[model samples]
Target: MAGSNFGTAAKIAAPLVLGGAAILAGMHRWESQELTVYADQLAGGLPTYCSGRTQPPRPVGERLTQARCDAIDAQTATEYGRAVLACIPADKLDQNSFDAFTLFAINVGKSAACGSRAAQLMRAGNREAACKALARGPDGRPVWSYASGVFVRGLQSRRQYEANWCLTLAEAP
Candidate 1:
């Protein structure tokens, strides 16, 4: 029975690892798919399009097909996943950690994610510490909990989720 349960669990989890399903799901859940370009006040009024995309901002009034938007998201997620993987060894990363840090890099930037205390702990092979660092700074206040100089409840929630996700597969420090 235990073996069968293991098989069932593996079947469910395999696709997530193979297709980067965790990160994709997080992106879709948090970044609503938008067909038209608009200014994202959360992103400091940067022009955005197609599921929170800001790079090479799409001109206003331009619309994107669902397929195009999905493609862009997949491409960006892959790029950010690679950046996160560089901080921690692939062998040490599970689906949860991969999702957590990849989502973090996608929300923030590659440079910020790569230079964060979380990344530093990951580099030092302390997965638990890295996970804890995602939510709280040295002063214990939530990290990445503000936008445009104002506290954002949504960001705080996201950070808390990410930190919890990071810890799911990590061993205790």
Candidate 2:
């Protein structure tokens, strides 16, 4: 306790830091609704932590190989994760928040959603505004696509849910 090295200090402080980050992240980030809906949009039918499509979009494990099959799974998740995380600057988000946010990013696609005003505002450190920005599209038009709106809403929901989960975890024995 008195003379701890990095390992001891890190073990003690890491949870505290993670808790604080989760609270801060939940403070202004998306909710579970946004994440789930967005996930559904992109997944179409798939669920969380998905891997190896039952009927892959393209050949795998045979011509391309099982490694490719697994790669496809990882690639999908990673792409979405990058997109979500990219929407917000690294400094602004904590670990748990980032996990939830990544769900949204994966579904919406970094190029499409992050390019929107929502991502722009989020990256600028105004997450609430960024979320509001999602209410509509670049055309300044109503969210004509239900899938689009659901995707945004789901992402928002997931962020909140993950943040809440972190809080719960922090309180656990």
lDDT of 2 by residue, 137-162 (tens): 54654341345236445544554454
27 Cα displacement, candidate 2 (Å): 22
TM-score for each predicted model, relative to the true structure: 0.83, 0.40
Q: After TM-score superposition, what is the CA distance of residue 37 in candidate 2 from its true location, in Å?
A: 21
Instruction: State each model's CA lDDT, in order.
Output: 0.76, 0.42
Q: What is the lDDT of residue 88 in candidate 2?
A: 57
> What's the C-alpha lDDT at position 89 in model 1?
65
**lDDT score, candidate 2, position 171:** 25
Report RMSD for candidate 1: 6.4
Task: Compute the lDDT of residue 168 as modeled in candidate 1.
Answer: 76
lDDT for model 2, please. 0.42
Worst 10 residues of 2 by lDDT: 6-15
Indicate the residue-level lDDT of 99 in model 2.
Answer: 46
